[model samples]
Target: MEAGEHQAVQLCLESGALISTQQHDLSTPVHLACAQGAMDIVRLMFSRQPDQRGASMNATDKEGRTVILLAAARGAWKTVTALLRLDADLSVKDNLRRNLLHHIVLSGGLLDDFHGEINERLKDFGDLLNERDIQGCTAMHYASRNGQLKTIESLLHFGAIVNLKNNENQSPLHFAARYGRYNTVRHLLESKKGHLIINEMDGEGKTPLHIASQNGHTRVVHLLLVKGALLHRDHKGRTPLHYAVTNGFTHTMEQLLAVHSHLLDQSDRDGNTALHLAAMHNKANTASLLLSLSCKISHNEQDFTPIDYALHYKHSEVAMVMVTHPSRSEEVMSCRTKRYTCLVEGLTAVMPEVMMVKHSFQALQNTEGVGDIVPETDQPLPVMNIMVRYGREELLSHPLCVKYLETKWNSYGMYFHMLNLAVYTVFLSFLTTNAVQLMAEKTDRENFTQVTSAQLASAFVYPSTRAKYFLDIMNVLEWTLYISAGLMAAGHLSTAVVDRSNQYIMAALAVFLAWFNYLLYLQRFNRIGLYVVMFLEILSTLLKVMFVFSVLIIAFGLSFHILLAKIDMNVKTPVFDPFTGNVTMRSMNMSDKGFHNPVISLVRVGTMMLGELDFLGTYLRPMRALESSAWYQIVAATWFLVVFIVLMPILLMNLLIGLAVGDIETVRRNAQLKRLTMQVELHTDLERKLPRRILTMVDKTEVYVYPNQKGSSSYVSVPDTKHVFRVHSSYVLRD
Candidate 1:
């Protein structure tokens, strides 16, 4: 049975040897003959075992490969035909439930060779042509996955269903995309049911485009996108764009963006957009590409933006790129109004829009992945502080946003804000008065209690949470109220001298900051707020400037320390020796003391930026003192000061001033709007924290708003002339 030759099988049969129904491996003589495509050996075996023909032909091997099925699958068409003549069971399937066609296609053979009688033999098993494998995949799916284009067409010609789904409900197109078979995918798109299956999703609600994108198959992705494949999300509400961004597939991302740039900003269920994934994955180059394409920096449901993700994940370079990208995207520049239409039934305003657009709405509701968002309009902000905190103040400039600001300001917002500010002033006043008293004052307990109670009540009404407070002013007054209260409490709790000293110091600081914060209250008005807004804008720009110059400052600091740190620069000066009671020349160290510490050295160099050169004290005095030591050291130190002055003070400082001055006009325009946004935020937070019973008791009167309304016009009654010659030229001339 193992030897597949006609003569050997014939000799064995003629000798009257009993024909074994099967071998050890369960392969019979018919199985070996079909496996080798030996039609003569197969016919001899079948004739020799005429009584056992069905048993020999229908028996399966270890892998459950049947005789006739094995022959067809292994391209033994001749032997398959011979087995058919011997009355082989046509309905026999392998253990995998695969039929004759499934075997042939899985063998990766082209069906073009099935001609004449072989073609006739396959047509009788029409149902087998569409029979599914264990995985619910058909022969067409196998052919497509293996890129057997000819075999796919041949199977189609043999009555194969073009859009037949496996148990997985996935079509041949889906299989083709899974393997990145570009040609097969294109052909499937051009097939009879091509359009129907292009966007057809699998059991997981994933489309062929999703599979191709997930695998980073750029060419297949391009073909799918070009074919108008819908940018649908899967059951998880993730789009093809999301899949491509998961692994930083740059080219695939580009293809998806080309077809639907809107998907770039579309968020998944978590509200995370594509850029957030790029940052989280540390795809710096991908982030830069996204920015160049005008992708918006959006916050997800957790209120975290792409930059936040990058910084959190330690992708500093990605954070920098995102932060430096143009704040205004293409969408911002192109913001325009469209003539809106209402989807209503019966062409009447009173008609329920759901009757006309219910199906459309349900489709959107059913769509798991993609959505259209108008964040500034559709998504409501929980608090207004988010705008100023995240530098989203630009949103206040939109026309609709302006209307929201107006409506919010008019509806109890103004009164709430004014009342909140009054409370904050009283709180700051109490903090200041307590701080001014001595640390161990006899009435310290009373003063401390007053301060705490005032702030506690103020916080219950409205907490003055600061956002990006002045960095320089923090040197003296960072969290002044909190620090002062803490020190006062500490002093009251312990009579330690150190605590007492800190109490007085913090007290003095609290008084200064209270005045400063009180001064800022003038910003509540529009005209003064312009200067305050401009100050903050300049301060922000200055922060960026400080960041960029930090490297230069460090470089200069380390160099200054290396060159002059150990130098003995003693200024020779006349001094009185008290012990001897006589005047004498004494050498005094004239070198800058800060050079001993790198931090102090950096501060000294940074101060040069503000025109605090210390030229005479550090450089000139040292040069004079060191003249007697070495002229070379003096020259080097002098030249170093000159270079530092030109770079730090002359160059960057002047440029900063120019930039700050240029911000005036823009500041003037946006200042009022920014203050309004801030005002609304303060009031909103206050109102949200109000007692529920008090809120219930509040007035329910409505405030009507009319946007962009033109001035009303009325006409005066006038007499009309009845006759044609009435009010003729002569009468007009007389008048």
Candidate 2:
């Protein structure tokens, strides 16, 4: 048995047996029953020991807390009513010297389903309202700490002192402001009896404003200022503005500045203004705002002028504005020679190749545009006539041209153009060796067959019939390749110029170019020819990636690098002799640096392989990979048909709806919690005044006390074992 679970005399009667008499170590049955709000047990126990009631009611527990004080602390309002009905002492103090009202205020009072029942309970015990604990903290102190705004208002209405200071010389308003109870502060300010805004200082000599600023409570600062709380300097001679800026309370600074701009120029004991602090900490926006307000700078401050501070710390943007001021232009000009020396030193830091590529690309983009060319004639001209009119009369001696002209014009003319050029050079080297083999070849042989394909494939006699046929095919292919290549090159050139204004358009064009190159590669069927096409495709893709990547790198890196170089120039050595500078530069070894990461190398290699795959796959359709054979053809016919036919858009629409619904639920939960908090504050403010009202009704002895119990309950009792056995045996005999 625990110390407080002793067998009371009243428990023997309830159990229908006389047990051994045992005394509780700290408290009797009445104390335990009242503290936990066990009302039925208290009533039964008190009825049996009517004479023991008064002594049990006044008994203190091991912790020196009275039963009523404990009940109030645990919010056992029903048990409190039972004890008070038996005339329990309400004036008793606990070990900490806190009274019943103080405990009630701390527990946020009893939880009640009905507000009327709560009002009745407070109306019965209102005389204990003015009682202070051992620490000189009243009921109002606990209410303020727990953010019980309604209870705080009630306490003030009951004549509880609102400005009363505790052991720390801090009042209720101080507690309210410190904990960010804005509504509670507003309530207290509105209460005529409550001090509008207590300027009382704590042990550290910090006023409420100092605490508010240090804690980043912008609303509290604003409230205090509205209620006329002095923004007074403390023992350290620092005002609220100094604290707000020093602690980086940007919102608080804005609030304070809205009413007081003179504080912007105010300096601390170190003689540094707010701008100086903002600059030192690299707070660019804050520094700019302060400078715009015309904050005065201390000229005598050592090595810490705003401009000097910015330059030393490498804030070139801020430093530029400060140094270029009309009043400081002379100083800036006097430092020009030094600036030039710094500029030369800065230029030495950049890589030379990077500079060259940047300048070359810029020059190419600045040239004028020319329109496309249209062919002048549709009919094929004779080779001799073309050679004579073009002023190249050497065609008669050219055997390839003479043979091409003798062969009647056919579709092979296109092939002859390319083959003739190759043959003329070959014939010039071996004039007498191949005349018979060259003239015996046939030009028109559709699906030409041979005993050994390699013999015919390897037979390369230029100006021969087979050679002319192959040359004709190449000439047609070359014209197509040139046309596609020109379009792609022109698109990229336009993108480079337009990218300066619109990045998204350039990105789209880059993607289109990748797909276009893939299509071009697919038209070439032979392996060697495929390799040549793929190489060109990879080159084009790499150029696009490099173009975009280089633009981004330069856009971000150049800004930072320029700012750093400018700052270094302004702060470092003023000037150096050109001869000495060149000698010093030559003494240092600066080359032999490159990107050494394996991952970057692997990524580059992987991109090239993917580009090759893209080129090859463009021609060969992977029909086996599709679910249905028709899918392959459908996809080949129209690219976007696969997605639209598969209901992808409907799935995306459902996903978006789910996300929007979840966001709405989150907003609703936040609003509910806020409402609950406000209601709790309002309830507390109402409960505090209940005590004083009860004191006014002291003359009426028929005080009606209604207890409100808010938690759930369960009943348990011991069963009779012997009676249960008798009942079971009688039923078995009857059966």
Tell me the deviation in Å of residue 534 in model 2: 18
lDDT, model 1: 0.67
TM-score per model over all chains = 0.42, 0.41
lDDT of 2 by residue, 1-735 (tens): 123333553556567532222245576656666666777766666667666666667778776767777788788877766566656676788888888778878877733321343355565445666666788778887787778867776676656777777888777777877787788777877777445445778766677777787666899899888887776766666677766666566788888888877788776556667766665666655665565656665531453555445555565444434433435433432332222343212222221111111111122112222111112232123223333345453433232332232221222322433354344333222221221222333221211122112112222332223234445543344334333323322333455543322423332343344344334333222233333443444444456655654443343233322221111111121344687673222211101111123334234223332232232122123222334544344244234223322322244335434544445534333333222222222222222323545423421212111111123111111123232111111111111
Candidate 2: regions farther than 4 A off: 1-28, 110-136, 193-197, 268-735
The clash tally of candidate 2 reads 14
Local distance difference test, each candidate: 0.67, 0.48
Clashes of each: 0, 14
Lowest summed lDDT across 10 adjacent residues in model 2 is found at: 586-595
Candidate 1's residue-wise lDDT over 356-425, tens digit each? 1111112212323222332333222333444554567665453334444544454555577578678878
Model 1 worst lDDT window (10 residues) = 723-732
